[model samples]
Target: MKNYDVVIVGACTAGTYFAHLLAKEGLKVLVIDKDSEQNLCKRLDIFHFTRDSYDQFDIPVSGDGDAEWVHDFDLCLSKSALDNHPKKSHTKVAVMHLPLFIKRLRERAISAGVEFHFEESFVDVVYNDQKQVCGITTTKGYYDARLVVDASGIPSVVRRKIEDDYIESFEITPRDKFYVLLKYVQLNNPDDKVELSTSWPYYKGWIAPQHNKSGAIIGVGANISYDYAYKCMDKFEKAIKLPEYTLQYEEKGCTPYCRPPLSFVTDGFMVIGDAACLTKPWNGEGIPSAWVQCTPAAKVVAKALSDGKIATKEDLWDINVLYQRGEGAEYAGTRAMLIGAVNMSAKDNDYLFANDIVFCDDDKGPNPNVVGTLLKGVFSGKFSLGGLISLMSASNKGEKLKKHYQKYPESPAGYHKWAKTALKLWKKVGTMADTVKDA
Candidate 1:
């Protein structure tokens, strides 16, 4: 058996980045993927990465001449259902080819001393006498490792195979996922070329610049399935005016939209990236968010594995604390609030946009009299009473969940009690899937 310090399944963005970080910590890391190197990350040809994230994560920036680089845009605009009340936000973003970007990440990981084995699919996890995960069985053969990390995206191959009390093996159901469909289209009018990303939150749709100067990508994500997403796109196009374009091609993908497992670690095992549902509640972007967990996790895992000490749940508990108290808490509240916020009528949505409420881009911050404004809207008949009540209830529940997460347990001894309360709170907070309207 080939022995390694850590065996990571899935060699995409999350796996390669984590492997590079861990290998830099002087651990022997090995990454395996079911797809060949040429085929990895080919599902999506083009994707966006915030320019500042490269510096924040210490990642190499792809320049204009680089194979991965397409172009950069500085503004993202969000509009109401009626196409009024456009909210503009500024952040430079790099457009890149996904497969080439993954190739770049892989090269970095290799330079950091991580081994890569393409075309090796995970079969199952190998457990020790104590029932702790010790290695993994792949289609090719068995490999022994002290730590096993699952960055296996949505399928969560390795994580789903683990039957442990600490780990939740629940499958990410259709309702718990965002099915995204992207249409690559060429603008009919040369003057109407897409230059920046623009989104309509009501439709969960956006049109962004593509690699070709005259081409753009129109995308929509919805619960249930790709068919539902297409239905949403049809509604969006009818409700708002868009530049005429000729369709070139289409691509589809899915991202986990549900809350992540409360615990991301167990004895000699950890799960990160999409496998752990580490995505932004607002946008369904997983790369930077997953790295947020990976930064602290690498430190904790490195320390636990130092001096050849066997890593246990007790030793890995800090990873949960660090994340749950920080980004996890923030996302919990935002996710909860969004469920109710998006459930309003199109007229009420336009009213909120006009009043600079939830969809506002005010640089000053949230309006202090938000409740008063909602009450005013209710009195003016601009908003429904039931909608107001639902929004308030969801906001209150979100705040409570955030507070509870901030008090995350510091050790395994206090975990079960904390988790029990968290589950109850999340049940009340609800999910984005709850906002899906009947087709």
Candidate 2:
């Protein structure tokens, strides 16, 4: 049997990036994917990445002439339900083709000595006498490895097959995912061409510049399915005035929109990226957020496997501590707060926007008297009492969750007790899907 230092399933962005990072540390890495290399990451044709993220992760920037590069924009605006009040933020963003971007990432991994096997699907995991994952069996053959990582996106192929107390194998159901539909369109008038991104958060829709100078991509995301996403798009078009455009094509995909597993590591195994539900709460973007976990994990995993030492849960526990107490904590609070923030009526949403409450330009930090303002809105009949209560309750729960995450156990010794409290808090926070009526 062939032996490797690490075996990673799913050779998409997460798997390939992690593989490259590990291989650079002198670890033997093997990455396998069910799809052919040519077909990788083709589900979405266009996506956006912030310019700063490239430098943060030390990835090569896609320039104007690059095959992956589509265009660049600096301004992003979010409008109220009535489309009256617009809140703007500035950040340089690069538009790129997904498959081409993945290709570039894959090339980097190859250059770093990471082995890749295309069209090889994971069948199951091989366990040692201690019930630790020692290797994985694929459709073609078996390969032994000291560490096994699951980066298998939403299906979580390898993670779902493992039966362990540390790893949660619950399927990401329709309710736990965001079904996104994108419509590629060409504007009828050159003057109406889009150069920046504009979002209507009330409808969960946005329009952003595409590769074509006179074209743009209109997208909407909702719980349940694409059919529901289409309904959201309809509601958005009716409420907001958009430039006239003809649809050229459409694409659809899903992203996890729920809290991630409390523990991402176990005996000789770890999970990252979409397999671990590491997506941003506000945007449902997984790449940069998953990289947040991957960065620290690579360091911890490299050290755990050094000098031929077996990586146990205790050895790998630092990955959880570093992540859970940092971005993980921030995301947990934001995710919880958003559920209540968006569960208000359209009139209430417009009131908040008009009053510079929630969707205001936050470059100067939040308003100091947010509580007083919310109370004023409630009394003025602009917002419902129930909505106000829900928002306050959710915000409180979010704070508690964030503080709890900050106290994340340094080792696995106190994890169960910490997780027990976290579960109860999350149960009360509920999910964004809960706010969707009839979904």
Candidate 3:
């Protein structure tokens, strides 16, 4: 039996970051993944994260920026890479290839003295007599350790195998958010920048410019029912016309966004990333938040083992409290902005668009190009929607929206109650809209 200080499953962003950090601290760490895919989990797309301060958008961004972290980077060998790359005139955010990023992280871990055990699937976990985590059982063999960190992205076998009694409070309702992304040929007009267009009836669509000037277009339909999502996936391809180009890759996935079970940690084990239900409520971004969570998690896990303290839910909650505080403030701000926009007049919308262009040019951040961020901010209640309208209509709609956004209860009890009521409102509005259409 092999034993170590810690064992982490899944070598993606969170796993990689944790392994690197723990290894640097001189803790023996072992990382396992199902495969050493050259380009396996790569999204074949470009991605950007908004500032840590903005949490309203679903893609997770950590408000905690104090953690020391590193990325594995390598220069692409292709000379035409720059020429073929997609234009981010819309937002000067960096393009990311997931596979490449993962590979780099793997190399970084190796350099930091973390051991890699690829192509290994975790079959079970070994618990000490006291019900503390002792290690893990893999298809290859059983490895013993003081702690186990489950970073297995979406489906966590360890989490699943643990008795339901081990589970803490979990969101009972299951939510499946689906999305489809495609790679299309680059347009002849090099001057044209990629744009994300929003639709009122369906989900909004995003187009990311990639290397070779090709575009990766994706559409997510979360509000629609699961059955509706399947329809949207098929319909989306037709809805977004693809230019003649060789298809490089296609990714389809459904995420469960409901709160995860409270028992994320047992006496001897812990879970992180998607497996731990760290996804945001409004949008489905988990990577950035996972990165943020991993830092504190790694630190705490190390401390617990070194200090002879058993890890518990309270420790996890301590981290969650900090994350929620920073992320919560941003969510509150976004809600304030969005409420203002929903109340805006048509004329004000136009003014907001123009002003967005100016902000797009000035702000140096990962926020969506100005217009999209402004619109998102309005919808999220972060920015002043009425202020945007004021540039044209001089209405106080922004103030009204601010008041409503402020009404969001800040306490845990208050938020839960508010969320429940809001869901009811959504259900009511959906029913009314359907009835009106039928009439």
TM-score of each: 0.98, 0.98, 0.61
RMSD of 1: 1.1
lDDT of 1 at 382: 88
lDDT of each prediction vs. the true structure? 0.90, 0.90, 0.51
Reference-based TM-score, model 2? 0.98
Q: Write the per-residue lDDT of candidate 3 for residues 208-264, one digit (tens) a residue.
A: 455444343444443235455555445544554434344566555544454444335
Between candidates 1 and 3, the one scoring higher on TM-score is 1
Q: Model 2, 198-222: lDDT tens per residue?
A: 9988888899999898999999899
Count of backbone collisions in candidate 2: 0
Between 2 and 3, whose lDDT is larger? Answer: 2
Stretch of 10 with least lDDT, candidate 2: 358-367
Report the lDDT of model 2 for residue 334.
Answer: 94
